[model samples]
Target: MKPSPTFEERWKRLTSRARMSIPDDFPELPPAFHTRVLAHWQAQPVESWEDLLATLGGRAVWAVVAVCAIAAGFVFTDFHEARISRPELEHVITLEAWIP
Candidate 1:
């Protein structure tokens, strides 16, 4: 049987294949490339129940919050809004549309 490669051997193979000379902070994609990629994704239609499910699953947090709020007998939006309004609450507020 062949001997297993050491970690250094595996890392050397990986780095050699992708020989990126740019600094880590350099952006790999251009701004126009991002726009084109976004347009491509938007143009592709969801074609199946599984696709629909996947799209819904990606937004599943709202469903989870709704279920929990229903079980607790409170309006889900109100509960979430109240949580956000609390002065002592420290949470990162993000744009939900971009939050996936």
Candidate 2:
């Protein structure tokens, strides 16, 4: 099996065989393509930061809503001063048993 020609070799052969005939009045590429490309790349981080801020802002609003809901639940609860019956302290906790 033969290996495929490298891009440089293929390009050379293709260009040599068929040269495109561009009109003399053909419009050239826009000036400073490099500068435009660089500017776009540099501006990406700022856009990303704005997106991050937007996403975090939405999450923060949800977080505040959840906290307010939880606070309301606690505030509406009937936390009575009910008497808690207890066993003798000696029977509840045995230091000698815990040490072993």
The candidate that wins on TM-score is 2
Cα lDDT of model 2 by residue, 21-99, tens digit: 5445866668698789889888775556778899799999999999999988876673644544465555546755685
- What TM-score would every model get versus the actual structure? 0.24, 0.31
Q: Pull out the clashing pairs in model 2.
A: none
The superposed Cα distance between candidate 2 and the true structure at residue 60, in angstroms, equals 0.7
After superposition, the stretches of candidate 1 with alpha carbons farther than 4 Å from their true spots are 1-23, 50-100
Q: What residue pairs clash in candidate 1, if any at all? A: none
Rate residue 73 of model 2 by lDDT: 82
